[model samples]
Target chain A: MSLVMAGVVGALFGAGLLVSGMTQPAKVIGFLDVAGGWDPSLAFVMGGAVVVYGLAWRLVRARRREPWFDAAFHLPTRRDLDARLLGGAAIFGVGWGLGGLCPGPGLVAAGGGATTGLAFVAAMLVGLLAQRRFARG
Target chain B: MPTSWLLALGGGALIGAASALLFLTHGRIAGISGVLGGLLPPAAPDRAWRLAFLVGLVAAGVAGAVVAPSAIGASVRPLLAVVAAGLLVGFGTGLGSGCTSGHGVCGLSRGSPRSLAAVMTFMATGAATAFVAGVVS
Candidate 1:
């Protein structure tokens, strides 16, 4: 039941990505390209998402004692900023600029049968595995 | 604002709604990298939800393509560039521990200082790279 809910949530998220033009690399790059012809359309996207989520967070905390499926709310507790976090974000930013695809959109695009999307997703997973291996060693 | 700003805003709300549903019910952040990353080693304790989320993401993408073809776009880049971008994104997200949806959307809403730093860092780097790469003027 929880798994099904997760899938349903994912689907809605994916649908949002599509409708908001996030699945388009050009749009993402355009928003990021401040020096180029800047497009502020995505700003609305961010604003809308933030506003909604902000309200939801408040409501959830005020009313919900426990999550529907989980015994308790499981949230990230790490608060300290570290070199790993900064460096990784920098790396991610570069890749995002280069390809204009993040994990969510990449997965969605791949599912849409784009070969380039498939390639990106494949390499991304490999990169994840490599990073994990390196971290462990 | 571009003509598509409305769409972006609406779509973003949907994304936020999905986030709310997942987080409110499960106490999960809906961070894509973390969700997907945990599945790499196939740990059975929490694999089901992640897998379900991903499956739903892809399935939704496919469905969206059929329903609204224009919402999806393709990334036209060299195979090598695509591969490199994918690897970097994967590794970076792994090390950094979040992506756009994770850090940019959910974390910021929760008012996490770490997430604020992460979002700024990645957005700056991403924009800078876009400029350096000549994608931005």
Candidate 2:
């Protein structure tokens, strides 16, 4: 059941990404180009997502003691601001601007038969593997 | 165009719904980076759901190609740039512990202060990089 739910949710998320024009690296890059040919479509996508998630999350949190598949909510509890967070985010930002492929969209776009998207995901997997091997915390 | 806005909003809503479903059912954040990251190291007990989610995500693009090919844009970048971008994105997301879906979408919706900071930093940096890259090119 949990797997089924995960699959369903993921499918919806991927479809949303495509529909929002996020599969297009150029479109995503356009959104980030404030001083150039700027596109505000991605902003609208974020806005629409936040609004819905905010309302629905609140209602769900209010009534639920635990999730249907888990004993407790596995939310993040960290609050402190740290260099690791800032530096990592900065790096992520550079990559995002460079290629316009975040994790989710990268995978989705690869599924759409984009060679560059496949390249991105493959490299990303290497990065992830490297982190696990070298950075033990 | 107005249709762009409509699609953006509509697609975003679906993304939110997917996230919400995952959260409500599994008590876990729908963070793509984290989810995929876990698989690299092979967190045995939780692998099934993550794999299912990813499969569904890919299916979405495959389906989109058949139904709405225009929505699924082709890749547009040199191979080297794409690989480097992927490496940065992977490392950064691993270091930071989340990506756009996790931090920008789920974190912001949950009103996490840390996520807010991450979002601001990444957005600013992303925009700045794109703007500067444009100037350079």
Candidate 3:
């Protein structure tokens, strides 16, 4: 049941990405190109998402002590701003600008069998595995 | 607001709603990178739901492509650049511990200072990269 629920949630999220144009590399790049013909659509998307989620978070905290399917909330507890976070994010940003495809959108497009999406996802998985291997050593 | 902008906002709300639903039922953040990355090594016991979620995400992509092909937009970047971007994105997200979904959406909604910093850093660098890429190409 929980697995089904998770799938439903994932589908909903993917639909949102599709609707918001996140799956469109050109649209994403346009948003990022502030010095060029800046598109503010992505900002609106983020703003809407943040507001809704923020409200829902408050409501959940006030109403429930524990989740229905889990023992406890698995929330991030770290508050410190560290070099790893900043540096990694900086690198990710460059890649995002170049590709205009993040994990969610990339996965979605790949699933749809786009050649470019498949290629990107393949390289991404390799990179992910490489990072883990490096970290372990 | 334009129709596209309104659609973007609505789409974002859907993403947020999905996140909220996952949190409400499973007590998990809908961080795409974290959820997908956790499936790598030292696999968690709760891998079932994660796999289910990804399956649903992919399924949605397929559905969207069939129903609304234009929204899924094609990539203009060459294969090599796309691959490079994919590698950087995967490695960087692994190092940062989150991507846009995790830090930009969930973390910010929860009012995490760390997330704020990460978002700021990535947004700045992403814009800068886009600007440079535009200049060069």
TM-score of each model, in listed order:
0.96, 0.96, 0.98
Question: Mind listing the fnat for each candidate?
Answer: 0.81, 0.77, 0.78
DockQ class, candidate 3 = high
Tens-digit per-residue lDDT, B1-137, candidate 3: 79889989998999899999989999999999889888988667789888998888888899998999887879868889899989989988888888899999999999899888988988888899888888888
Better candidate by TM-score, 2 or 3: 3
DockQ of each: 0.83, 0.80, 0.85
RMSD for each model, in Å, please? 1.6, 1.4, 0.9
Q: Give the TM-score of candidate 2.
A: 0.96
Of 1 and 2, the candidate ahead on DockQ is: 1
Query: Under CAPRI classification, how is model 2 graded?
Result: medium
Indicate which candidate wins on TM-score. 3
Collision pairs in model 3: none
Model 2 ranges with Cα > 4 A deviation: B42-44
Model 1 bad stretches (over 4 Å): B42-44, B135-137
What is the lDDT for A125 in model 1? 98
Ranking by DockQ: 3, 1, 2
